[model samples]
Structures are given as structure tokens and as C-alpha cells.
Target: MVHVILTHEVKDFFAWKKVYEEGEPLRTKSGIKMTGVYTSVDNPNQVTLTGECASAELVYRFMSQPELKAAMQAAGVISAPDMKVLNKV
Candidate 1:
């Protein structure tokens, strides 16, 4: 499995979490598995998460979807997310 680390800022962490939780089924259908979420110690609006997926390629494809963009926007993502995929060493 490949893991992706994603970081971004949200207008409101709690509101964003509500949307993220609601979107779990969509992610599962796309073959993405998520871990517990996280935030900066000093900045609750700054969010981060690690997700496991079949491949880095799948992660990019899922991220590029228009619906995903819409969902992110609705979820209060205020910045373009930075994501990196890693394979266990």
C-alpha cells in the first residue's frame, strides 16, 4: 500500500471535519483508506491527514476529480493542499 500525506488549511477545523466524515463512503469507493486526522499544535485550522491507497497514481487521480474539488471547497479548505505519497522503506 502507498500512503499519502496531505496538508492544508481550513476556515474552521470542526466544520471541515464534519464534511470529511460525511465523505468517507466516496473515498472508500475510490479505494482510499484514511487514518485518524491531525492538526498543528498551535493552529487548529491547519489540517493534515495520512491516507492509504493502492498507488500514488490513484491518489492523484482521485484528487484531480472535479467533484473532489467541489467537496473540498464545500468542506472549507482554504488553501490548495500539499500532498506527498510514500512507500514504506
Candidate 2:
């Protein structure tokens, strides 16, 4: 299994959380099993989503979709997301 970590800052964490929750269908379709959602210790606006997918390709494809960009915009994400795909060493 591959792990995907996507972190970013949002304009409003609560608003982003609402949109993120509504994206369950998208994540399911992309074969992404989200394991956790987190916020920075000092900043509630900083968000991180952690999950597992079949491969890095799946993650890239999911991230590249226009729907995702739209969702991010709607969620008020203010910064470019930092996404990393990693396998256990």
C-alpha cells in the first residue's frame, strides 16, 4: 500500500472541513482510504489529510482533476497543497 499525505492552509478550517466531508464520494471513487485528518497545533487553519491509495499515480491523477481544484477553491484553500506519496522503507 502507498500512503498519501496532503497538507495545506485554508481560509477557514470549518468551511474546509465541511467541503472535505462532502468529498467522500470522490475519495472513494479514487480508491483513497482516508485514515486521518489533522490541524496544526498552533494554527487551526493549517490542515492535513492522510490516507492510503493503490499507488502514487492514483494520487497524482486524483489531485490533477479539475473537480479537486474546484473543491479546493470552494473550500477556501489559500495555499498550494503539499502532497507526498510514500511507501514504507
TM-score of each: 0.96, 0.97
Task: In candidate 1, list every pair of residues with a backbone clash.
Answer: none
Highest TM-score: which candidate?
Answer: 2
Candidate 1 positional error at 82, Å: 0.8
For each candidate, what is the lDDT?
0.93, 0.94
lDDT of 1 by residue, 1-89 (tens): 89989999999999999999998988998899998699999999999999899988889889988888999999999999999899988
What is the TM-score of candidate 2? 0.97
- lDDT for 69 in candidate 1 is 92
Candidate 2 per-residue lDDT, tens place, 1-89, comes to 89989899999999999999999999899998999999999999999999999988988898998998999999999999998899979
Q: What's model 1's lDDT at 4?
A: 89
